[model samples]
Target: MKGRTKLTGLVIFRGDPGYEAARKNWDPHTDRFPKVFVFAQRTQDVSNAIKWARENKVPIRPRSGRHSLEVNLSQVNGGLVIDTTKLNQIKLNKKAGTVVVGTGNRVGRIANTLAKQGFIAPFGDSPTVGIGGITPGGGIGPLQRSIGLISDNLLALEMVDAKGKVIRANSKCNSDLLWATRGGGGGNFGVYTKYKFKVHPAPAKATVYRITWPWAQFEEVLKAWQRWAPFVNNKLGSELSIGPKKGGNVSMEGLFLGSKTEALRLLKPVTSVGTPTSSIIRLLPYTEAVKFLLPPDPILTQRESNQFSSGFGRKPFTNKAIKAMRQFLENVEGQFAGFFFLNWGGAVSRKSPRSTAFYWRDAQFYVEWNSSWLKPSAAPRNIAIVRQTRRKLQPYIVGSYINVPDQGIKNSGPVYYGANFPRLRRVKAKYDPKNIFNNPQSIPPANHKR
Candidate 1:
């Protein structure tokens, strides 16, 4: 460690004033009391933190936006958490039609930033999700079908390797590393600092729509949506949510990259089925549409306990499958329980499966469900509800999304990366041979089989 980079950022030891707040993640259930937290202000700070952690023989975790959903993914007991929230810097190249952004930026910030420039970038539903985490796992949202996953737009990235050396990856250099980072999942190879993304010019105005139905109409509405959503015009992207009978209702919300007339016409299939309790459609500026589609930016300090599971639907759900879903929803006791579906064709499926580490390109739709609770006592039942639902729907689902990690899934490497797992392992070997960066489900170097 003779040439080790000294820790140069805001380093907070366990007993520091902000240690309690710095150690918390988006979900309270996954938070842990780390030995130290380093809020990285620059790339060198990240490198120094990695070297400092190694010098002290402490586990290391890279965190941004603190939105990691699973335990130990972003924070660990007695570990070093390298926080990147302060590295948020946005540089737009209008001439090249691209943007180079710090990985620490959140989804909502990027959306709002790009919108102000009259450009748009793909983003997920949650405004608080960090780009550093989501982009690697194939970021999905309303713009997926229209603009492709955030990873698909990725052009280059800068990362600090296991040895605390800064490196750049793109199509020209360290190409394999670039390929893996596209969809191979974060915390596998290195800690990303900056990302160069191919951005799209935004249309002046777009249509945003929301349709709701009584909870009893879940079956009919779901059937209609599944049949129509994936095959609809690529310009339109939609999501359907089926909530628990206790405190939920069926609803569909989407953004159409066109006028209200065309959007309503394309939505006829689902809109014609169940007698919707209410329907609202409006044409608004692209920036406003983003605000309308996404939930409000979450308070960074706010925390909750929750269990989440994810999967891909290769084909439409059969009656048995639909019945199973309904049964699970009916039996779930929590008010914060529901299933979310996103149509998954269009630009997402245009690329070959092997093009990037993301391999679920052929899926027709994506589905995920969550069971959340405020009390620690409710953990068991809530976790069981999600696990049981996954078991019942296992036959109809294919792979799981790495971003939405589910600890219950055995042999998750294949479930998340499919055939690309081997290549990802090789990349891991090349970039992090000793596996300096690792988590519960992180890929092992190729020579060391799991």
Candidate 2:
């Protein structure tokens, strides 16, 4: 452990003052006990930590927003954790239509910052989710229908490899590395320090709508949405949330890229469905519209004991799939359980599967099944419900979203990356030959021993 003794740069061990707080992640299911935690403040710190882990023969994991659904991927028991939460710095170049953001910057902060400057970038809905994790995992947010995935907008990145070498990847240099980072999944590559993204002009005024129906109408609403949302205008991004089982409601919320008048006109067919309990639509400045999407309190998301699984719908939801979903909801005993569908098409589908490292271009919409429990005893049942829901829809869905990692996926390489896995392995071999940066689900080198 000579290397461990030599390690420096704001290291925190077992009984350190902030050790308890620092070890916690967004998901409560992950209970890891690392021997050491390093709060890296600069690119040099990240490099040094990697070198120390290698020399000391200790496993390591780099953590940012700590939002990985597969908790073990970000926490290595009895190993070392290199935290990049202090590297938050942002610079926006409006003239170039690009922005460089530090690894620690959260999605909400990034969105609000860009909105004020009359620009915006596609990112996740959560305000506290970090850019470091989302960018590489193929961020699909409300604006994806128009602009594309956050990975699609990534222009460049800087990272520290397993050997403690700082490298920059972009169109001009290390182009392969840049391609892999786009959607290869986070914590698989080296520790990311910064990302430069192409931003789009903020619309003059946008429409935000939230339409809801009683729980009894979930089927009718879902059927219409499964067919309509995917083929709807490219300028619109819509999502459906059906949940909490017995007493929950079914709702559809979306954003339109044009005036409120046009948005409503386009949504006429959808709105004309069964009696909606509530229909609220409004037009606001681009900045205001963006703000409306933020969850009331992101901190609550971290405290929820939840399991999230995802799948891609390549075709319309079949009658059997719909029936399965209804039965699943009817039998729910958990305090909270739901399914969410995010529209996928337009700009997202316009790109070929090989265009970037992300490979799910043929999906109609992405489906997320989530279940939450209040006590430890309720976990097994809730988890079973979530898994069963995924199983029922397996025949109709293709692949899963990397961002919403599911522990049930025995072999995620094919599901998450599809045909892009081999290329990702090559990139892993080239950049991290020693396999110093790795996890349970990280991309393995072409000749990896493990």
Best by lDDT: 1
Local distance difference test, candidate 2: 0.85
lDDT of 2 by residue, 1-450 (tens): 676435656899878888887778777777588988988888888888888888888898888887767767778788888887888888999889999999988888889889888897776667878788999999998799899999999999999988888999999999999899888999887999999999999987889999999888888888888878888889899888898666788888879988889989888777888899999899989888888876544562454578889989988798999888888778765455788899999999999998899999989999998887667787788778878888888999999889898888777787899999999999999998867777777778888864
Q: Candidate 1 overall Cα lDDT vs. reference?
A: 0.90
Clashing pairs for model 2 are none
**Range of the 10 consecutive residues with the lowest summed lDDT in candidate 2:** 295-304
Worst 10 residues of 1 by lDDT: 295-304
Mark the regions of model 1 whose C-alpha exceeds 4 Å error after superposition: 1-5, 301-303
- The CA lDDT at 321 in model 1 is 89
